[model samples]
Target: MSRSPCLLLLCLSLALPCMADEAKPGHMVYLRAVDPGIVQDIRYASAHNFTGHPLDGYQAPECLLSVDAAKALARVQTALNAEGYGLKVFDCYRPVRAVADMGRFANEPGDPLKTEFYPRVDKQDFWRLGYVARVSNHSRGNTVDLTLTGPDALPADTWTPSAHPVDCTAPYGQRWHDGALDMGTGFDCFDERAHTDSALINATAKANRQRLNGAMEKEGFSGYSAEWWHFTYSANTQKPDVMDFPITPLAP
Candidate 1:
């Protein structure tokens, strides 16, 4: 006996995986698809990032990560939600092309976003300063740059070409408003103050960093000391090394 079309469709739904599990290249999934509770501010997808221009290979502002990593992140979000705090990711699952774009920008002659992103440092020295790496772990799909947010977090601002750029290391209230708790400095701030354990920040910033680090650690995410917002979930499902998949938008 042949099955009806609708029945066949229902059977397929049960037999195959959901869009979240298959929309991405091998084992990768959008973080929001897994946990919408976590906020996302993918600056590299827009002019709001240090690159000034949108980075290459970022077709959309979506946070993509390895399956194991996304599940670990979701667990962290659940834990933070209970405490009235949430995770806000800035970058995830970057493409290798985007990393190359960063290197090209670093070697170029212009510094349009200098005031806001790397004020005190020169762009040419980004590699030496350890701000821009020739090979980024983000391409591996398990690393993420994120911040913590709570009820009192500042409101994120709308960025435009005409918007004035503020120093990333400027005091919390004076810097670009990203609706994140003051973690010493803004996300991607190349200044020493952005260091996870920098002593220059006030008591509040220190406490917030500690809290965010502790929460991520509890979920098995390793925090990068040089960048307060950087974390990596060690158990990656995809293992061919750096990925080149473009971050495409979810089906509307």
Candidate 2:
């Protein structure tokens, strides 16, 4: 006997995996965990993106402050999107597993400086710089790692795709934000030079760093002393759990 269309639809629902609609209310959410939360409500800021990759494995609520951080990010997204640039997050609401991964990888006695994670720094120096901490604010779901991109002077709807190439050895140049200013080192630079207000950098780079810092500070977000690309909206708020969740895209 042939099955009815309604019956076939029901069968399909059971057979296929369901994608989450939005973020959960109180529970810790990650790229891996999903619940019957609301749809995508947070605005995106693409200004700080690399190679046009989606900021996967990101979870709100935990990544963002309950009220102020969320609003500031929304405004940040709006301001950037208006200029044809939006945010692309690399991580948000990191799970405990992820933090463990960083720690495990850090403790592994091997050459990681030549590796993609910390290409510029020496394997032994990473620990001294505190770039690879055993515990990360990311686990608390308040840390974010991002970069700026193009679409400069174009309408948001007509923004063109741009690539963000990260080379460890290359001299830091104007990769993004043409007129805004330079932040001494590139977004991912792990050297001590990436400090928010380092005196070792050129005057122009210092000014540029200040510009970015001011924008983030106004929104109540503070920068990580080591890495200019890192920031947390809720300076003190942090979660106990750290996890490693892969970035899975939402299906159409």
> For this target, which candidate reaches the highest TM-score against the unseen true structure?
1
lDDT per residue, candidate 1, 1-252, as tens digits? Answer: 233344335335544221221135767889988998898989899988888889977889999998889999999888989999999999999876677689889988888889998899998789988889766789778899999999888898888999999998888899889999888889888889998889899999999999899988988789887899999986544443666667889877
164 in model 1: Cα distance from truth in Å?
0.8
At residue 237, candidate 1 shows an lDDT of: 44
Per-residue CA lDDT of model 2 for 1-252, tens digit only, reads 233344335335544221222333344333222322211222112323221222333333223322344555555555655655444343454443334344445566754223223556664565688766545666455566654433332112222344344443244442332222244654455666777666777776565456556656766678888786677875444533433343234433
Model 1 TM-score, 2 decimals: 0.88
Q: Least accurate stretch of 10 residues (summed lDDT) in model 2?
A: 35-44
Query: For model 1, what is the error of residue 231's alpha carbon versus the real structure, in angstroms, after optimal superposition?
Result: 0.6
Q: After the best TM-score superposition of candidate 1, give how far the Cα of residue 62 lies from its true spot, in angstroms.
A: 0.3
Per-candidate total of colliding backbone pairs: 0, 19
Q: Residue 48 deviation, candidate 2, in Å?
A: 16
Measured over all alpha carbons after superposition, the RMSD of each candidate to the real structure, in angstroms, is 9.9, 11.8
